[model samples]
Target: MAIVLTVRDSSGLKLAALATGFVMASLDVTVVNVAGSAIQQQLHASLSELTWIVDGYVLVFASLLMLAGGLANRFGARAVYLAGMAVFFAASLACALAPTAGVLIAARLVQGAGAALFMPSSLSLLVFSFPDKRQRTRMLGLWSAIVATSAALGPTLGGLLVSAFSWPSIFLLNLPIGVAGILLTRRCIPPVGGRRVRLAVPGHVLWIAALAALSFALIEGPRLGWLARPVLAAYVVLGFAAAALVTRERRAEHVVMPWNLFRGAGFTGANLVGFAFNFAVYGGMFMLSLYFQHARGAGPFLAGLELLPMTIWFPLGNLVYSRIAGRIPNGVLLTVFLLVAGVASLAMAGMSTDTPYWVLAVAVAVANVGAGIISPGMTAALVEFAGVAHANVAGAVLNANRQIGTLVGVAAMSVVLGTVTDWNRGPGLSFLLLGGAYLAGAAGAWWLIARSERQARNVRR
Candidate 1:
């Protein structure tokens, strides 16, 4: 028997959808990052293999995201999103029971693809559903809050699961969430028709290959010698091939990131900032956990407890910002936040076992406070300028940028650590990498806003 439910108000139902998908995606992103070592030990993965364990999913997530949005457009956002949730739950089972590093990495790759599919449409549904600008912005703010909380709490949750059960338990956690999401989705998300089209399969293959090559080169380059003929050649060839793929995509009637991605300086600038922010953010969390648990000898539960400040404070920061959202200029708020966060992170490079717990708490809190200020405002700017027709696709682009940013951040930090088990030195390097990345993020905020102002005037036409 089929049961039907009416969404009394699409706004509330959409918000519920946003909250569900954001938290689920954010949890997967952060938890796996924290559980790296547990999986590494159990699987006996080499440092190179372990690097892929993290970067592999991020890369595929970014790569397929171009396609995910298109699929949503061609096949109804609700259908694609529901399918993604199903795939995510099934992949979680594979991740939990994997006997080999190869299997885990493969499972993680599918998981990333599912995440890519789930996130964009869920967010797009929010964007299109909320008709008023103020309501839309606030809904996104609420959406941002959920994602930020999950991201902040991921380490703690990962630690708890790893400690209470085992490393595989981290992946196991997704099943119930998926089941719940499916039920909620059925009730809240309206069914809609989809566009009809043939895929740009050749271009898709080219980009996927490019992503795989680029991921491998970047992960291996630092350790294997970046200047080595083989490494340099791989990067050079991959770069050219990727360029060719873009050109081919541009000429296709059905382009992914149409050449119009460079519509103006504002779009380009905002996109760049999104990238830099993610680059350092994801890796920084992973590296810090390694420092706390592996280096400081803190138990998983204890380590999670230590990380509670970021989780608790992040939502609070959003709550504060939600109160004063429209009053503040998006650019000004973002710049100050990123600058302060960057400085605080750089300060974290000096933390030690002898350091006071209050000091660590302050550092994490400061960074998250900045995250609350910048995230909603930045996303708002991007969506406001992107327009509804392209909303799903533009949001997909943002999702890819954010994931890639995380991959780069993690990769940069890993290179600094050189696969050593030393915890004392890891934090310092992680801090430096994140600090530099945030500084770049701060610059991105300024550029993004400047461009958005012009875009706003143009859109009024």
Candidate 2:
């Protein structure tokens, strides 16, 4: 009994350390949204520049995630995790002191690189810490709740800080969180040994190039004109780099991505679900943040308050997941959640600039609850499918895809905002796009995940 108590206490401390890292990472993702207006005013940034400020982090983070996972496998996960925390801490400081929009974007890119390194390792550590399937599912739910809470609080916290101080305060907030994460990680989490895994450098480089070109085309298309020479050239580059990367990875002796893992339809579906989930959730959040300030003429503090109704339900959904996780099939749960979110988002498509706050708020709150449930449910399903052997690589793939979704989602919103001069039409259109993404995820979950589960059960019979 004494030994059991000691083990449980140790696991609790380890969880705390992991949660700190997640808080910092997730906080940055949403907190910066509320600071958009403030950052724009102070930096005198253009719409494109503002979009860059947001996407720069996601772009680098998404591009490097697979490499980071490979590195974690090659080097020890603990070492890589600590290194990432240190880098993120320094980058946050640079972001806080950025003199120009360009400087801030650069710092954000560095911050993303750090996040890519740590994020996958954090999941791997959590999986290893709780080896039992039941206990791991519970911990995953708890971890999701912690992350959701931080993200849900981001806008409100950023608003309060920006109103009281300035936009820089949002970045400054990460400093303490970073310090706590590093110290606690060192003291609590046990070190996992490294393996001799090969890093596919060429494949990674091509992958990065492809994503960069695509982002350039998407973010710059509206400003440059879709037919502009630079935009056209970027499109060409994007196509070439993507094709080359795919070919290279297919033939590589040692691949960066675990292709074998993706052979399972369940795994593929989970990745798709993760991608669509981020696309809708992050994209919708960005649009609504701007809508509150730019369309509704709200101040930073007011904007944050307005966003609270939409974001606060995420933690509640995560808590609900913990109770129903094992009772329901993951595929069925995901399908239902996606459907709820999709329908709710579609309801928001009718919203105009003059729409009542409560109306929009209720719609968003319902959508958020569904999104919140999907996050942990999808994660738990993917982890179960991947098993412990491929935990690091699998985690990286899911997160990378999700970040890619976020990058594309935000870029898509920028296109809508830039192209449509009318705030009323633009926001409604954005909601439509978000709705489509969610519904698409639901379809994939039903087709791939449910079918796979049925096949497995049939085999057992």
- Best-fitting candidate, measured by lDDT? 2
For candidate 2, report its TM-score.
0.97
- Score each candidate by Cα lDDT: 0.76, 0.89
lDDT measured at residue 286 in model 1 versus the true structure, 0 to 100: 65
Backbone Cα, N, C clashes tallied per candidate: 3, 0
Candidate 2 segments exceeding 4 Å error: 1-9
lDDT per residue as tens, model 2, 266-297: 99999999999999888888898999999899
Q: List the residue pairs that clash in candidate 2.
A: none
lDDT by residue for model 1 over 231-332, one digit each (tens)? 788787798878988788767887767448657555566677788777766776667666666677776667777777655666666766777777776777
Model 1: lowest-lDDT 10 consecutive positions: 1-10
TM per candidate comes to 0.91, 0.97
lDDT of 2: 0.89
Q: TM-score of predicted model 1? A: 0.91
